[model samples]
Target: MGENELAEQFGVTRAGIRAALIDLEAQGLVERIRNRGSRVRVVTVEEAVAITECRMVLEGLCAAKAAVAASDEQLAELTALGRAMTKAVADGEPVTYSDLNRELHARIREFSGRRTAVELLERLNAQLVRHRFQLALRPGRPQRSLKEHLAVIETIEARDPQAAETAVRAHLGSVIEALRG
Candidate 1:
């Protein structure tokens, strides 16, 4: 659908749809055609692998550091985020689960207490967002993700940096396998 039709379908104005489309295009979610209008971009498998690989390294490091460095409040926040993910998964709310899952990982990165690492991770994160698989929310996967994340959190809570890192690496490895299959 064109901008006007999309706006009408969603009960919004044409201008609102136009602006949203422009924003999504800027974010690489929509590809603008010279004459054929915009289309949703499909993320290829290779792109997904690359994004997951980068995230595995950066976020693994974050989990390790956060285990060693995060303050009590920070840990609490992370735990709360994990619980939110768990609830979403249990409820089979894919959209909420995916969002909370991302937030959980981002929170770990944020609480790592390393400015350089956080900045680098955030930059990588923006690029990876475009490649995120909606299938991550497939009924069983979110619950599995919650369990893996809880393992990471347990290590973090114990201040076992190496264990936390290993947990994240293993979790991400599973994700890679899932993506391949």
Candidate 2:
């Protein structure tokens, strides 16, 4: 968005538009080119794969911690989510499955109680929205990921930290492979 055009369209001052764009840029949602103004940032496949590599470690840690730290209530909710996700996939609803996929990861992070990792994962995930959506819509992707996600939930529910971490790592490793493709 051009600063002046956005300001005029939104009835905000130029400074306000500039400030908004600055925040978006900091969040990796927008790219500001000197004279070309700004546009939604495009994350290349290579970059997406690299980001998923980082996510593998953080998410695996979160899964392990969530296995050890999550209460019974949290575990029950995760189980419910897993059931809903399975239904979504069986019903051939990729969009619903994709939304549930995001929720599953976010909830796992929340239950982990690792604030720093959660915050960083949130930032990294925000940048991967387009790529994730694309991957989720691939022919049999949701079905495959459902098994992976259920493995995660099962390990967490069983309170097996090592298994939970391994499940998460394997899930993200699959994601990285998809992104690479």
Candidate 3:
């Protein structure tokens, strides 16, 4: 909130701090008022649901495309990641599973070969970190989502684009429901 304080702590100029704030504001990570300075932006529950709704569509497209476009090597990596996620859940490490969940989604996006969708997903995901993390730590949440995610990987490995897209929508639809709670 204090640009001068930030500048002094980082030994940077006020202009530099202001510029950084500008970028964060553009990213929806901060809110700047005309004269009240800047503060961390809080994403409301409704906004989270809206964001997840958007993700359900875009990520479904990515999953479907990845099913068709992913190379053999990419398939192998995704399979391995699924196994790792299973192990993480079985070992009672939701945090680790959550991290692997991110990796799995990222790989799918990359394999889809849709640069624009991947970029937009990245921006949207940046806004969901807190909600996603909290959900990951919720009791039984990881276990439930694990099967959904595995279904996505399984369908993609089966080279079924329609099924892959359905699986992705199902997964994110559950996310939307949870966010609404």
Candidate 4:
């Protein structure tokens, strides 16, 4: 976008937009062409795969930690969230299911009791938003994802760290496969 457009959108001056664009360019999150203006960088297939793989490992660890650390209240909340997601699936509301899906994962990270991991995961998740939305748009994927989430929640509630880890990895592995396709 043009510097003026970004400035107007963010309520900043053109100079401020330029500075921010320069920073984003340096971070490889945008490309600044002399005449063409800045644009969000497109994620490569390889980058998407790498991000999914990293998420699999990190989220698996989070599930294992959550299995050990989650309290009864937290587990109850997860159960409620799972039920809501189920209803969303049955009602054929992909958008609602997607929102609940994000919340469910965030709660799992919160229950993991690892502040640093949660923060890192948030950053990683921000990078995956576009790809995740694409995956969610796939036909019948939401129901399958809901089942995987239920499995992960069940393993966590059962207090089986190893099983929770395995379940999370499997869930994210399916995501990786979807991304590959």
Candidate 5:
């Protein structure tokens, strides 16, 4: 679909869509061709691997801080979101999974009480999502993602700070491995 259609569909102005598309294009998530206009980028395997590496570091910090700062209510909410993420992946809804993944990470950063880290992570997430979406759409990746999400949630719930960080690291590492293979 064209940018105009997309903007109209979302009830946004063409300029808004144009600006967003331009930003995404700069982040390598969209490709603006001479005449063809913009298309969602098809992530290369190497780019996907790189995205995983970046996520490993940011997500690890978020999880570690969550272990220290997450209240019982926040933890419970995280658990619920974890379950929702798992279900979204299991259902093989890549778009839904993408949205849920962003929410899960954002919530973790927010709960961690690290405003600067949260802002940085949010910016990183935009770039990472572009490549991660490619990996998520691969065959059988969704189920594997669900398993990894559950592991991270379990570790965080236990309040084992180091373990939580390790779990997130392992999960993102596995994603890198999967993308490489």
Candidate 6:
């Protein structure tokens, strides 16, 4: 949609839409085409894999740092979130599971105490949200993901940074493979 239309639909100013579009364009999720205006960029499988690979490393770092830096309260929160995700999966609510999944990761990043890495990972995550959500819809994927998430949380709770990193990388690598399939 045009900036004016988007602004009207979102109840924001034209400048707001323009700014948001600029950010999206920078993230390679959208592009401005002169007369054609801005459009959602089609992500190829290769591009998706690249994004997933980047996420694997960044998130692994986040998990590792979180293992070392997270307070007992933060660890409890993660455990609760993981339980909630398990419930969501058992209820067969993919949408809820996906939302909880994102929240769990964000919580880990927040607890990591690394502002720069968290910021970069958040931006990369925004770009990957669409693909990630689609992947979450695949049969049995949500259950598998919940199991992986719980395993990561277990490692974090154990205060094993290396194990936490390995768990996160393995989870993200599985996500990349699923996306490829």
Per-candidate RMSD, Å:
4.3, 1.1, 1.2, 1.7, 4.0, 1.7
Model 5 global lDDT (CA atoms, 0 to 1): 0.79
Candidate 6 lDDT (Cα, 0 to 1): 0.92
Question: How do these models rank on TM-score, best leading?
Answer: 2, 3, 6, 4, 1, 5
Winning candidate number (lDDT)? 2
Question: Which residue pairs collide in model 5, if any?
Answer: none
Error of 4 at 133 (Å): 0.9
The candidate scoring highest on TM-score is: 2
**Tens digit per residue, CA lDDT, model 4, 66-166:** 99999999999999999999999999998889999999999999999988888878877877788888888889999899999999999999999999999
Q: How far does residue 27 in candidate 5 sit from its true spot (Å)?
A: 6.2
Residues 70-171, model 2: lDDT tens digits: 999999999999999999999999999999999999999999999999999999999999999999899999999999999999999999999999999999
Q: What is the number of residue pairs that collide in model 2? A: 0
85-136, model 6: which lDDT tens digit per residue? 9999999999999999999999999999989988888777777777888988
User: TM-scores, in order shown?
Assistant: 0.74, 0.96, 0.95, 0.91, 0.72, 0.92
Clash pairs for candidate 3: none
Q: Give the Cα-based TM-score of candidate 2 against the true structure.
A: 0.96
Question: 64, model 1: CA deviation in Å?
Answer: 1.0
Of the two candidates 5 and 6, the one with more favorable TM-score, higher being better, is 6
Candidate 6: Cα lDDT at 134: 96
In each prediction, how many residue pairs overlap at the backbone (N, C-alpha, C within less than 3 A)? 0, 0, 0, 0, 0, 0
lDDT of every model, 2 decimals: 0.80, 0.95, 0.95, 0.90, 0.79, 0.92
lDDT of 1 by residue, 74-124 (tens): 889878988888887777787887887788887888788777877876765
RMSD of 6: 1.7
Runs off by more than 4 Å, candidate 5: 1-44, 89-94
- Per-residue error for 101 in candidate 4, Å, reads 0.8
**lDDT value, residue 63 of candidate 1:** 92
